[model samples]
Target chain A: MQTLAAGPPPPVTPLVVIAIYLGLLLALALFSAKLFRGTSTDYFVASRSIGPFMLLMSVFGTTMTAFALVGSTGKAFQRGVGTYGLMASSSGLIHAACFFLIGIKLWAFGKRYGYVTQIQFFRDRYESNRLGYLLFPILVGLVIPYLLIGVLGAGKTIAGVTKGMFPETFAATGGSVPSWLTGLVICMVVLAYVFSGGSRAAAWANTFQTLVFMCMGLLAFYLISTKLGGLAKAIEAANGAHLVRTPSELEVASKAGTFTREVGVPSWMFLTYMFIPLSVGMFPHLFQHWLTARSAKSFRLTVIAHPLCIMIVWVPCVLIGLWATAAFAGGIEGTKPAALNKVIGGLPDANVGAVLSLMVKGLIGDPVVVGLVTAGILAAIMSSLDSQFLCLGTIFTNDIVLHRTGKNRFSDKQVVLIARSFVVAIVILTYLISLRGGNVFDLAVWSFSGFASLTPLVFAALYWRGATKMGAYASVVAAMGTWLYFFAQSGWGGEYTVFGGVMPVALSFGAGALAMLLVSALTPKPSQATIDKFFPKF
Target chain B: PQRLIVLLAIALAILHQDFWDSDALVFGFMPIGLFYHACYSLAAVCLWALTIKIAWPRHIEDWAEGG
Candidate 1:
């Protein structure tokens, strides 16, 4: 129920920081335009020329968005330690496992086929333009919701931090930058870079942002932990606050509700969690990365190194969430009852306010360092949002436009222009969606679950010759439909449900795979010539 | 083709859930830690093996061919 502080003067610094970053990003994009004059590949996939550290940075930056920083800490505020242990830790390890086993194979195939998008792989494997036709739309549909979550979260965070200082930083407008205007301007700058340079600019910017975010995050953690009496005192405070121990079955059921008697994670949801990694191949941004890897070796190395990056970035987030949970046990706003009543009629909208207060309080020892950490969070959100929207724009142009028109002859400049236009359109749509309000974390997870459901079929197409066009198509539709249906029913409470949790998503994947397997068995296979043409060494 | 691996990971993740949920176990140790380590090790081996099977030979050829 507590309200956030009124915004004004100190905020001008944050606005200045955002403008400088955007200007830099725009310059890079313009530079990328110079490179793009010669080839389409240079624009879209950076001619698959990324180095190891750059590849590592790009992957890291793209995945860890506002979800890992603010949203995660917020979740920790509500759920406690096991949320980190079960959800964050396990999911990361599982994702790493996928990287080792599946991601490497995709990289090899991407290299073999010179695939620009997941659609290319599907089209080749299935020998059906229909799959491409169906999947491009479905992938876009899935991306919209995910993009909504990421973009909205970024917008909201920017609005929160730089509430009334945009005019000062941007210097074009006479008045202060409204929250909406700030979000829109930031999105515009991101689009400018992404549209101009395509993946190359995103890659370089992401690398820079990733390094800065990591260093700042570590610095923030060091300051917070040392100031708050180190890990031992923090642990003692947390445990003393009864925030670290396992919740009772009743407690779990009451909070998670509808999933009773089951401890830890609800049993019914196990399959859903299982299917997510499969969706990796289907994520356009991730697929783009697959295409951008310089060689099979780079692809393999990138995937191998990704988990390490995920681990470092996420551990601090988990610790912060747990610490936030323990430190602010009255539920952030719950601690300030009088303020809550004055603000939102005793509601917990103050959770955001309270957590921010704690964060601000935690940084009392060093304001400059805190400012940098805040900048890092903004960078994380912007980096992920920019890459995702850029990739989504590319798919919209390449998959939907060029394919339907039956025209692959557009000049690189024209394609880039068209793609940038889509980026602008998508930003507007995302802003509208954000205004309607939804939990960014839940939306993000559902979006991932949606895309990931199709990952297994993509793998089959790339590696398994027995997979037919009909089967691959069936798998995609069925998996996507099943995922959409169950995920909607699961609600946004972040609890593992009996049916809708990870278990159902996994089942949907199985169902899709089975459909593909059976359908392929019944159908005529692609010719050996086609197979050799696409996957020669295999 | 990699669908099986995805499924196995999910299933093992479920087993991980079981380990965390339980107080008493068939063995003296916490099954969660045991399963977590076992899966991690097994996955590492598979990764190393796959790398060797496909990548190592290619590396050797590239080394020889480049020379």
Candidate 2:
């Protein structure tokens, strides 16, 4: 019954919240065992029978990951209104477009071929086992780091919110719990739910988690509004504290084509911030959601319903982030002199971190409320991690394993087992990788941008009739190589140059698309008969 | 019709940067809050129409069979 509304608790209170949340997750996992008994279709895609509302929740739940909750807000707090605003506002529109343009066509094709994974779809469409073999491994490689970030974020967030209740043994918090142990534990729990019930469990849990997360967000907004004398006053306070300042540090860094600049960025960068939405349609987990959709209509309806949820869910996060920025910046204004000094002295090095730390500390008023907020953050991370695990696992098992073997075949049971096993493996690998060290936020952007280059090949496969198998393979290789090269160079120079932080990704995607098109035209188009076989006349 | 939807989406995007200003005004059982949300919904609908009409054109079917 620990609620996050009232605030922080005594030293050991985080342990109680951790215990309760883990207990609930485990119970849900065990309960989902019934879903595991069905065939592979039942486990993976739920036999494509999911209704609209459920589908909407599933999509929303899966996408609202650690990045959506914590990373986005933290950036907003540090950088101002520019970083995530455009993305949050446009994500639903992007998703809906994907649905109308691709999801329906994908569903029609997937159902026809009994496609279970991206590789499967590619193989059918391209009519090239060799191409599938090549593409599969690359997808798995990209999926690993992307998947790792989500798992790592889940562990880090849990550790942060619970005040070190479930500490990592090796975590050098200068004496704090090591991130390794925390990551391992969180990863284990995620592995359990996914392994036990497979995709079905993930979908159901996603629905439940979505509700909990949304309610927490709404509650946070309500509390903030009421406590601060409503939205108008809060906005006024924000404005006064200069919290609405734009052209955040990232935008500035992006403009300079370097992360070396420690302060904020040029304001003009925010105006052209389209990569956020572009990345959404290209992200692996998002792509998996499209594949798992039950029907085209369900997909469209789900997208239609998604933005409303975003408006509600994100409002609190944005408000809270902004509120924290203002509250922390002003140094406990209107308070007694001694109290004001105390608040000012306790501030962290970073603005957003200081704000979050302060808010959590202030929660000392109610352990229950503290628990709920902590739960809310953990829920966000877990939702993201679970989906990432499943997506990567499916990519590897279907694309890498099955494709390489040229055994265009697997029983549903075997496929399910392979997928779950990969989930376990990925969780373990990510836990180990996260221990090596890097900023959580940095890892997220890099991981996604790393794969952003592949967008072109995907488009070619879906849209271009001239696309040839060799062309697809060539495009993926060239695009990925170029993108990776830039990513590495940026890291070496201590900044992502070329066109803001997103230039390399954009360029790579364009390069890949160009390569595919040119090669497709030069190489023979797949025979009409082959094309007919893969994409039959409706 | 498609052009109109596209125009509408562009308009909404242009306006998305500005925060909604709601001043309470009474209407039957609907609070000014609900009424405001309804207006927001209209904007959303326009955006939705823009999505289906332009981004996801119906002629996707023509391409579907070819490739």
Candidate 3:
């Protein structure tokens, strides 16, 4: 069985670094809180005070959760370089398209109407109170799993890095930090910031975390590659193991003892993966971030720079994962360094989420470097968690509590209090559910698929004046119903794809779009007043 | 100009498939398909910058700012 590296006990440097990082975030949140105007709007959307740079960082940071870092690395290890082509490049294009087409328009509406949640805009556009009621539960349902992904990833990553540090005390957990404790601490750190300063804190924290993770990702990439003999040598080793083979060629290679795993991504699956990035258009957290923008001009930097940022972050991670296969193969053949072999002695197929963490720990000798990289990974996870927690809170307060009790029924203080209470509740619930554990990448893809299915509604709401409330209803029902059915049909399996190659997102998105078009054509047009309000003549 | 940018975006999407480079390696090491995408992403960044300059819906911004 694989075990932590033998020798002297691991140092506490990584744990210390992570603690200091969390402390800095708390300090930043406290500083942001001092600047808070104490109004619900200021709390929820930062009073639209965010400028271009911060807005770019926050939106990009929030969209990239554990799904980008931990999940991508694990997936790349399981698959190959094709993993980057599947998600990163497509996301670069599609995500920017959403930011340009959907984000700006929604920001305009929110600023004009004093709206804080997506359900408010949908309710006003469709002129249906019942729609908000329907959407609130669905949006919250999807976000919970997303929150779980972050929490679970944090636990697994921290535990993986800190292995052998507490050989006697944490002997029950293989001398690593227990996931439950790590998860609880991460939850509390995130909750402290979001509870104190809301969106502004999230934005500030995201900007800082984004910078840290990017730099540290590069550092880890350089260090790991240098340790593995260099990028060219690393790639050559992986190639010799046939680690780059496509799925169709994998069986033959494996039978001939040239490949050890079916590690290639298929073509159809790659094409369909583009649909997953459309989830951004319908992300409630992203909607909240949009409303925080100071102006539509603020989005220009985001739309243009986002793809480049994705490239910078994803290339290193995907390469690191690809190199891991070579490293492991070489270790088995006695061709690798002893330290590297000690940590990653076996294929991590059973728990691929730990692959990136193991690679960092195995290949990098300096405790400080390992600590910095672990902190970077945790930053990526918590940055997204704070925004999600705050958005869910904002939705519950505005769409459910305030909408049901009547807006005039509560003072600003009471409203903020209600939002805070719900945020706390969600943080606890998500933390609890995360303990059940599932694959981070698979869970994230499933969550994004559900949101992507709902993108048609956002598109129609913004641009299509003829889109009726019934059409919106039909679109949502058809999309979510199909999503749930396929999710069940897959038996909740992470590898489940449609037609043996396509992602389930293709079917869900199609069902939703078709429902929107047919139902909108059959139903009465929206009122002229509503159309004029939403799509005013210049 | 707006129509041109939209067409260009569609073109970029199509170019993203890069199926021909699937098995080839660049620089004797890097997967050619992956390198193609790295370049493709950079191209997207340029395209989007051009879109912002030429195809942005300034009218909506004007309305929002003016209001």
Candidate 4:
């Protein structure tokens, strides 16, 4: 009697598009895995045969993440346009400098020593295998939270897209897809590609995802602006009301411990935030990606193109977040503009990234296109998660299992299996944590600070041959201590900073470098042979 | 490389000036600060390209490739 409804069953919804996207990802994984050579080398480092273009794609993809897409948008929503200068421009320059200094040198060393992980390089360069114990925990510990950023972003994005899709059973979360299911699904998809295709698959997936996100990001910007009565109108509207109210004569801090709406960003905090991007020079995932290079020349494209890529991806997302302040203020559907404040509440109440989704759904209303663009955002999030998951598995297998246990007993297959199992375990743990929820941008900034503080170690290792192992340990402790000090100063919410605006990284970076330089001077220098090995005559 | 690094550092300095953060929107559209960053990003691409062409240390770059 019903006759199956009307008109091609209304085509496919955004949820179906997402389902197709996931299915394609699995297919890509299985294909890559099938091509896998079944060697531990193949599984972990992709035989170090990746070329320049793919190298560019994978490295950029890994760097962007949900933080680049979701977190940047959200931060921009809270902080205003200064967010671009604070993160993107600084990242553009700092990341390239890092590639030239840290990435190229490490890749050369990795090739020479057949190094598979950062811990492996540190252990040998310092002539202290036990350093692995300290470094491994520190690196993996920092990374797990980074992984949570990706998983949490993915969950938020999916939940945003699927709003009202499950009204009957899932009315709890405004009928949107729940984060737990989204997190679990993302974890499984990333794990499959990583477990199957290994590093090559991750590299391949990253390339594809990066392309998707860039295109979809631009499209989303154009379409959303058009929906908001064009870019000029959108910006003009943003200059109005609570979105961009004229500054008050008196700048007062709110009960939430933040400056009132009228206060602009202080100059000192803006400068200090520059230190955060230096964290890239020390990211463990980046170290692994560097080792996958076919030659140092492969880095040429990455260095040159990376900033441009950052420009393309970041500018749009930042603008979109800023635009959302005005558009969301105007109201969604029949909702009155006057009711906006009560609806979204204050700065802390706004869901910046979620605003992106709501804008897409509201503005476009084309399910298929909305689905594709949402997939693009998801692509950016997952691309990084896969690389991170793979990197964590790698350090565990190479640094901990083989080096620490002194076990040559495991076969190549078993080594890959051990890595795969570790990846699965980490995925499950990250999924569970993501269900509890978090502010993706805030979590990412803290993780970046931790790694940024440790940057002195790598720079010292590469440039200063007299850097003794004891100094290495000292630098880690000092940096970690300062980091924790600042962390506790903020009551562990990663909120506080010195001088009101100066980021914690400013102090921690100084502490790390000073400790390394001073401790190395007092302690015994590394042997001349060791110096020759790493830092020989030009 | 040091000279190139200095040039890159200058690029960062030029872009980081808080002057851009003022209320000067580009053609009544893009924010001036963001517009400056867009230009800065392009300059970065050109600067790095020049660095690779002129300052690449071949010996150091090929150090581990047995070149």
Candidate 5:
């Protein structure tokens, strides 16, 4: 296994590089703030001024969070190459479908009616203020864990890469900056920009960060593969080490009594995993990003290019994770083999979140390269954080605050102030909760499953004019209730599947869709005015 | 064109379940299942670009942009 030198204190170059990267991001935020229009519309949705490339960047950036980079690498480290097929490729296809099918329609609705939050659209579509009230807390509850994933992931990556750099000063944490401190700093940095320029700043920062991470991801892929003796050699080594097995291979090996691991991702699980990516269809943050488009034409680039972007970022991370399994097959050097036996410590008990960082630090020679790659990972994490923070704040201000205390009561500046205050409050709250860390990948899957279950509501709203208020209410209640039941049954287990092989997302999504269809069929159709408003004839 | 794109997307989704290639490898290194999906993602890119050029909702653009 590859290893850094054992004796001397690790170089501080990576930390300095990361500090510089943060400074650059803060500077970019300040620059964006100078261009801020200082209106609630501008603050929440960039005043619908973003064009194609920036729109594509921000949308893709926000979607590709710690879950994609840190979480996928960790999952691949534990699960093998099937992890890529499980999420990345399916996400590439489904996320683009959502952008084309759901995103464009929602953007049109938002522009036509001056809507800034998803709850606002839901309330109007269902003609029920109570529906908005029901959705607000549920959406907020689901998003908190998503936000926690980013915060926890950023802290893990930063600490893992910078370990042993400050041996004397931080001896307690194995010479590493603590995860809590790192998380706090990350929360504050993301808050700075989102508070300053809101959605526009987030878009600008996401564009820059997306560029940084994609470039750095490719660099990390090349460097790590080279360090492990090239891509072919790395794959060959992983295959030989029994770390890269397909489901059929595992099945055959099991029959021959040569393999004992839990049958590499079952065919049923693999097929049902497709439902998880549909979560993008109902992502509140994505809805906000969609509303930022300058024209319907702005979506063309996003829809077309997003799949390719997923390919670029995900392929390298998955390959690196596969390689890490082989590279560390003999266990991490200088640590006991039994203690650090598996590459990422074995499934449910593993600190899988730090596998990518551990691989980067252990193999790469130059601290600067490590710093740049760490910054890249941090960029992906923070980019999503900014958008989620802004969206949550937008939802609070628009759905709850303004709805309760009439919109006319608050001036435009006051509305912005309310949003900013909520952003700060959520940032602090997420940071505090992040300290009680959980598995990044599992938390993300649970959060995404919750969102996926609600997609039936969005689909019905846009396509079926018969969808009524009661149907919408029933859909939300059924979906979330199913989600809670499955979540409780799973007991927060990482590889929790329903019916032995199927993902819980499939069950939740089905329950929601069935309720939406059945209830809508039994109820009165939506008013003609509402139908005409949402589905105008050309 | 829209129908074609929708049909193509559904076909692509079905093709995504590449259980047949699970045990095969390409170039003695890359798993065939993973490689197939990589190719599948690229195919999606092409199809989506075509959708934008041929089947994009022009009326929505016209309305939003005041064309």
Candidate 6:
């Protein structure tokens, strides 16, 4: 978006803006902690004090993340405009369905049984504490990659915004801020709020960040188009020679085109991407947030307003990515002075995640505006990271440590301490793993497949009378084993795709549902009493 | 009303079917297929708003505080 257009090296405005943003976040964390009652319930569920508007903002904020803003934009450059239909539209409808079908029921059960996590729900429903031995690792394992996406995304964005900050010292990064330092800074800022205020602070902070990213992102869109010469002119410049161009005949590739093997979306693959959103039905972070709702009425705003919020964030990101393809078609801006082209030219695939920031800096020619957009992108990312970190810590404390040893063995304060400690450990581990190279969007899709496969377990747990303990076990194994098989078969998904264009999640989803059905039928159903607990006669 | 909500979900999926997304534009600036979904997104929010008003399970809202 921002090419190295003729100008002084972009000022360190973004670095200053990011510093201001992080400082504000730390202050918010401190204030929320001050309001904390210092109870485990207070830490874990925010004492269930969140009202409707706050709940809606926090849930939508946590769900959006880098995937909605950065990943969608970057992926669009590679995949074309079909990226929007594949994700944003399906997500608009499917996510609300999950909130209704799973979230509300879980909250009611949580209030009834004093449950705070998904593991607690399953373990009690199946009458098996040993389920955690199988579940905790799988749940935590799946979530870490998703967490890495947020951290890695924030790092890449900051690196772009502050390109000249360490130009002399970091020769390879073109003096851009390095990702590792960026990652550490974000981890620390998120940890500050989550460690002290826990779920409540995450909710309050997410509400604020969600508003910031949305408003600032739209502003970036307006200013970027104006800088390129209004919306219509900008679109014409990018589209006439780039993505919006329709080929005469035959699905052929061009030097400017992002697609390699195919020119347009495959029919079957387009159909199956819908399954991807089903993963939210089982997301542990979402589960934790659902429990923090003050009442089932609180879910109303989230279910109704989520789609509009998604549209506001995604439309600009996707369009910007598409335009980048047209703008950087030659791959090097030889005619445009090197200083002006420095932000965009010469990077392979044009670095999709950083497009919006580059567009701001290169076009608007204002440091403060670029910095504001960088903060917005980081806001989209960090909002999700805090919730995931807090959820993992909660699962460790509630499911593994307390379930195995004894719930009463420790005081409430001690339990809260254990959760915070685990969150810190997980953050460090994820940040290290993110240092290795990968496409943020592809890696995210791989991670989503794992959770998508596990959705059947929750669906059956909530609604099916025929689901049994052995059946749940079989479903988990079948889904995960299929995921691992496909993940490895593709050589870690570098050239991954099923025999047809179908996504791997569809196959695993079928296997999981079948396993639950057949195993429950053969290996005896749970007593009607157990069923009665989950399926009460209301 | 509940049936209408279920129908809306089906329509949402079908509306995004993407069978013929290429070779067209809308408003002289957007692809016809992508443009269709952009409007679909707005409609989804409206549909869900109505569902919340008419079809959401009101009994669930009656959660006993100490349950």
Provide fnat values for all models in the order shown.
0.01, 0.03, 0.60, 0.56, 0.54, 0.58
Candidate 2 vs candidate 5, TM-score winner:
5
Off by over 4 Å in 1: A1-11, A18-37, A97-114, A162-178, A239-245, A249-264, A267-272, A328-357, A361-367, A407-409, A432-440, A491-496, A499-503, B1-67
Best by DockQ: 3
Assess candidate 4 and give its TM-score to the true structure. 0.91
Q: Please give the distance, in angstroms, between residue A81's alpha carbon in candidate 2 and its true position after superposition.
A: 2.3
Question: How do these models rank on TM-score, best leading?
Answer: 3, 5, 6, 4, 2, 1
Q: Write the per-residue lDDT of candidate 3 for residues B9-63, one digit (tens) a residue.
A: 9999999877663545687667776788899999999999999999887777667
* TM-scores of the models, in the order given: 0.79, 0.81, 0.94, 0.91, 0.93, 0.91
- Per-residue lDDT of candidate 1, residues B25-59 (tens digit): 12332223223433443453454445434444254
Q: Deviation in angstroms for A90 in model 6? A: 0.6
lDDT leader: 3
**TM-score pick, better of 4 and 6:** 6
For each candidate in the order shown, give its overall lDDT on alpha carbons.
0.59, 0.59, 0.83, 0.77, 0.82, 0.77
Cα displacement (angstroms), candidate 4, residue A266, comes to 1.6
CA displacement after TM-score superposition, residue B41 of candidate 5 (Å): 0.1
Show what share of the native A-B interface contacts model 1 retains.
0.01
What DockQ do the predictions score, one after another?
Answer: 0.12, 0.13, 0.59, 0.53, 0.55, 0.56
Tens-place lDDT digits, model 3, residues A1-538: 2344466777899889888988998898778888878899999999998999999999999988865766677777777788888889999999999999999999888888888999999999998999998898999999988888788878878777777789898999888898899999999988988888888888999999998888888998898788777778777666333344367332222212343455677788888989999999999999999999998899999999999999999988888777766644544222324645434434445455666677766666578887898888888888889999999999989988888889999999888888889999999988888787766556677999999999999999998998999999999999999999999998774666878789998999999999999999999999999998999753
The number of clashing residue pairs in each candidate reads 15, 17, 0, 0, 0, 13
lDDT by residue (tens digit), candidate 5, A143-218: 9888887887777777677677788888998888888899989988889999999999999999999998899889
* Residue A75 Cα positional deviation in candidate 1, in Å, after optimal superposition: 2.6
lDDT of 6 by residue, A1-538 (tens): 2435333556776678878988887888678788888999888889877888988888898888766666676666556677787789889888988998788889888988888899999998877777768988999988888898888787778776766666577768877878888888898889888998999999989988999899887887787666655555555544332343222112323336533333245677778888889988888998989999998888888888888888888888777666555544433222223343434433334355565555566567577887887788888898889999999999988898998789899999899889889988988888888888466545677888889899999999998888899999999999999989998887775435686688888898889999989998898788888887788733
Question: True-contact fraction for model 2?
Answer: 0.03
- Candidate 4 residue A431 C-alpha distance from true site, Å: 2.5
* iRMS (Å) per candidate: 7.4, 7.5, 2.4, 3.4, 2.8, 2.9
